[model samples]
Target: MQTSEYLTNFSAGIAPIPQDQWQALAQHCGPFLQYSFLNGLETCGCVGGTTGWQPHFITVHRHGTLVGAMPGYLKSDSYGEYVFDHSWANAYHHHGLNYYPKWISAVPFTPVTGPRMLIHPNADKQIIVEKLLEQAGRLEQFGASSCHLLFAQDFERHNACHAGYRARWSVQFQWHNYDYTDFDGFLSALTSRKRKDIRKSRQFLQASGICIERRGDGQIRPQDMAFFLSCYQQTYLKRSGHTGYLNQEFFEHLLKTLKNRLMLVIARQGDVPVASALFLYDDKGLYGRYWGSLRDVNGLHFECCYFQGIEFAIENRIPLFNPGTQGEHKILRGFEPIYCCSLHRLFASEFDAAVGEFLDREAPVITNYYHQAHNVLPFNATFRAQLISSPENKKGHF
Candidate 1:
C-alpha cells in the first residue's frame, strides 16, 4: 500500500479555509464547532486581540483535500474558559514561570462538550486524531507553555490520553431523555416530591401571567435579539460589573448564519418580553448557553431555561439537555451529574510532573463528588435503575 501524505497547518482564523470544506466535516459535530458559530465569534470581536483569546484554528489536509480541523486559541489569561485554570496559572507565576499564552483547542467561551479533532468519516479516524493532537501540542514553535484540549468529546478522550496528555475531570449537570412522550412523561420519571415541586413552579408561573414562548430561526426578529442582548448585558453588568463578552454583532451574525440552530426561551408579560434564555441545538441535543432578565419574576429562571428546554427536547426527540455549568440547583431539578473532561500536554518536565500530580490528586475528589451528587438526584427508584443500566452511567461517564 502507498503511504498518503497528511499535511497540517495552523492559522489565526478559518478565513483561508473553504467554508464548504469545513462545513462538510462540521455538519453534525454540533453548533459550537460549526464554521458559522466559530467564525462569527472571531468576526464579531467576541474573541481575538486583547480579549485574551487568539484564534489558532488548525486544518489537516490529505493530498490537498481538507480532512480534519480543530478550533484553537492562544490564551493570554483564563477569563472566559469555564474550565477554570487560573489556579494553574497562579502556580506557574508563584514558581517564576509564565502560563500566559498557553494554547487551547476549544470553542472559546463555549464549555459544551463536542468534537475537537474533527475528521471526515472517510478519513483514517485514529491517525487523523493523533496527527491533530500531536500538531496542536507543538507549542515550542509558538512560545506557548502547554497545550490543552478543553471539553473534548468522550470518543477522543482515550485518543488524547494515548497521545500523552494528562486527563482532568469536572462535573456538569445534564438532563437526559429516554423516549419521553411529553413534559409530563418526563415528570413521571422523577420522585414524587421533586415532581410536585416542578409542577408547582410551572403552575405558579402560569398564574403569574408570564407567558413563556420559544422563538427560533426566522421567527426571531431583530428586536428580539436586541432585547436578548440587553438582558444578557444587564445581567453581566449586575453580576460582573461589565457588559458580557458577546455583543449585538455576535447575535446578529448568528441570526444570519446559525439561526436554525438557535432557540430563544422568551418570557413575556402581556406582549412585552422581560427575560430571555438563548439555546443552541441540533438533532442530537439542546444546550442552554446564556440567559438573563430585566425583571425578577419568581421561578422565571427555571421555567425559561430548564422546563422549557426539557419540553422542547421531548417534542423534538433530542436526547440530552446540558443547562450550562456550576449549578447545584439543577441537581434537585433532575439534571444528572456527568463528567466533563479536558486533556493537557505540558512541555516542561517539571510542570508536567507537577500538574500531573495535581490532576491525580484532583481526579479522585471530583469522582467522589460526582458519585455523591448522583446519589442525590431526584429520580424515582425505577428511573434510577434505568439510569444505572444506561450506557452513559455504565461507561462511568459520571
Candidate 2:
C-alpha cells in the first residue's frame, strides 16, 4: 500500500496547486476539470465565504510529484448538488443527528457530469482511489458527519462500492453522436415520426424569423457573455426569485481564463439577441451548461439548446452531448437516459446500514427506469440497433 502521507493533503483552495501540475491531471477529464475553471469559481466569488460551499480541494503527491486531485467542498447545505440528498439530511434531523458539514467532491452548480476524481496518467489509479476514500472518511475529524462523491464517473462508482461506500444512482438524459455529418444527418437517424416532429419545430422557428447561431473558441465576445448572463439571471429570478448560483464576475472570469472551452448558442429575432445557451466543450464532449431567454418563442428553447448542440457535436465530432439534468423532454428528442452515480459513507453505523439499504432499493428502480426510457428515444431502427449493440449499453454503464 502507498504511504498515507502521500494522500490526504487538503488545502482550503485550488489556487495554490501549480497550474501545470493540475492541468496535466485534468487534461483527459474534460474542460470543467481545468485548473482555470475550478479556480475561476473561487476567484470570482461564485463560491467561498458564506456560500455554504467551503472549498476543500485535495491533492495527492508522491516524492514531490502531483498524482491525483479532486474538487471538494465542506458543504453546509445541499442546494447545488444535483444528486439530491435533502431527504437524507432530513432523516438525520429527525434523529437529532447532524448532517451539515458533509464533505463532497463535485463541480459546483454544474450537473453535467464528466469526472470528479482526477488522477495522473502514470499513477497507480487503484491505490489513489483507495487513499482518497480514506481521506474523505477522515474528514469526520473536522466535524463532517459523512462524505459524498457526487456525479462521479462509473468506474469510480465500482471503486467506491469496493471501498465500502454505498452507491446511489440517478438518471440523466444525454445525446450520443454516431458519426453524423450534419444536423440533417442526425435527423435522418431518428424515427420518421420523431424526425418530422423535430423538423417541424425547426421550421416553425425558422419561419418565425428567429435566427440561431453558435459562437465558440475566441469568437465569444464580451457583449455576448453579458447578454447570456442577463438572460440566465432573468430566468432564474422568474423561477426561483434569485439570480443563479453563478455570478457575472464568474462568467467574466471564465470568459477571460477559460474562453477556449466555452461556447454560446444565441437565438436572435431580427438582429436582436433574445435567447442563449452556454456550453463547455473539449475534443471529448459538448456539455450544455446553461440556457436562458428574453422571449419565449415557439420551439426556440429546443432549437437553441438541443438542436444547436446536436449540430455542433456532429460538426465537431464530439461523441457525447449532456444537456444538463432532469429533463424527460430530452428523451423524446433523441437524448437517452444513463446512470449517474454518487457515493455515500455516513460515519454513524446505524445510519450507514439504513442508507445502504435505501440505496440498494433505489438502484434497481432507477436502472429499470433507465432501461425503460430507452424505448422513447427518437432513433430509427438502424440507430436503435446500433444503440442496443453499442458497448455502452452492453456494459450497462452503472
Candidate 3:
C-alpha cells in the first residue's frame, strides 16, 4: 500500500529491519515494543519454531527511510495470545473453514497494553494507520482467516475501529499510583479491613523469616535466574502437566539484552531464595510479567507479587502497575479494573459478520463487568471519592 511518499513492506522476520531504525519509531512506547525484546523472542526460539508464532513484521518507509512499523506474526494456534479466539475458531471449523493461520500484531505472551502501530513522531499518523489497515487486509492473499491486534492502546484501538475493525473488550486489574508517599500511605487509602489484611499478609511473611529484595538491571545474577527458573518450572509443572511457555534461554536472552528494563523481586529466607517475581518497565508503567515460588507460604504469593510491586511503584514513582492478566484477588489488594481492547478483522465476510455481532453483544457485558469490579475495590469511601473525581474516571478510561 502507498501513502503519499511512503510505501509499506512486510518482512519475514524483524531481523530485516535495522535495530536502530525500528527502535527509532518505538520511542517512548514500552519495552515490549522495542526491537531488542521482539527480536530476542525470535532469536531465542520463543516465537519461531513450533511455538505457533511466526514473525511477519510490517514496516513503512518514506524514500527508503523507515517511518512506521508494527510487530506482526502469523499464528498457527491461539495458544499464547491472551485474547481468546477458540470459540471463533470452532465456529470456523463447524463451517468447514480453516482458521489455523491468522495474522496478529502483538508481543508474544505479553498482555500489557501499549502502542501496536509504531510511527515516527514526524510521520503522518493518519496515512500510516491507513497503510497498516491495508496491509492487514492483504492477509487474505495468504489464505489467513483474520488479522488481530491485541492489547492495543486507546488511540490505536480508535484508529483500527475507524478502519472497519471490530473492537473486543476485556478487563485487567491494574494499580495506579496517586502520589502516595509510601506503602503505608497506599494502604491508608484502602478500607480498614483491606488495610488490615494487607498488613497481616506482610507481617506473616516477616514472621516467617522471609525478606524481600529488589534487584534491578545489573544487580540480577546468573545464579538468581537459575533459582527463579526452577521455581517457574515447578509452578507450571504443578499447575499444568507441562513446563511454562518460556524457556531458560529466553529469559537469559532477556536478561542479557533487556537487563536495564528488568526488575526481579526475590523472596528469601536468610539469603536462600524461595520465590521470585520478574517485572518489566519503561518510563510509563511497570509490568508484573512472571512469578513463581519453591514453597507455598501462607502469604508469600501476595507479598511477592502484589505488595512488593506496590511498594516498588510507590518508591520509584511509577504511575501504573499491571500485575498480569486475571485475578479477582487483586481487587482486594487495591488493583482497579481497567478495560483492555483488541481489534479483529476476519477475511471471510460471513465469519466477520458473525464475530462482529458476537462482539457487539459482548462489549456491554465486559463494560458492565468493569463497572462491577469497581464496587469491589478496596479503596475507602474518601479515597474512592477522590478517585471518582479524577479526570480519568470522568473519561471512563480506568
Which structure among the candidates has the greatest TM-score?
3
How does each model score on TM-score? 0.95, 0.95, 0.96
Candidate 2 per-residue lDDT, tens place, 1-398, comes to 53755746887878888889988898888877788888989998888998999999877888787888878999999988888888889999999989998999888998766677888898888878776777777798999998888888877788888888888889999888878889888888888998999989888888888898899977999999999999999999998999999999889988898888898999989889999999999888899988899998988888888999998899889999999899889999988888788888899999999998888899889978988897677777886677667776653422
lDDT of 3 by residue, 71-106 (tens): 989999998899999999999999898997999999
lDDT of 1 by residue, 39-58 (tens): 89988899986799999888
Candidate 2 C-alpha error for residue 48, in Å: 0.9
- Cα error, residue 295 of model 3, in Å, equals 0.5
Off by over 4 Å in 3: 1-4, 388-398
lDDT of 3 at 393: 60
Q: What is the lDDT of residue 38 in candidate 3?
A: 82
Off by over 4 Å in 1: 1-4, 385-398
**Clash count, candidate 2:** 0
Worst 10 residues of 1 by lDDT: 389-398
- Count of clashing residue pairs in every prediction: 0, 0, 0
lDDT of 3: 0.87
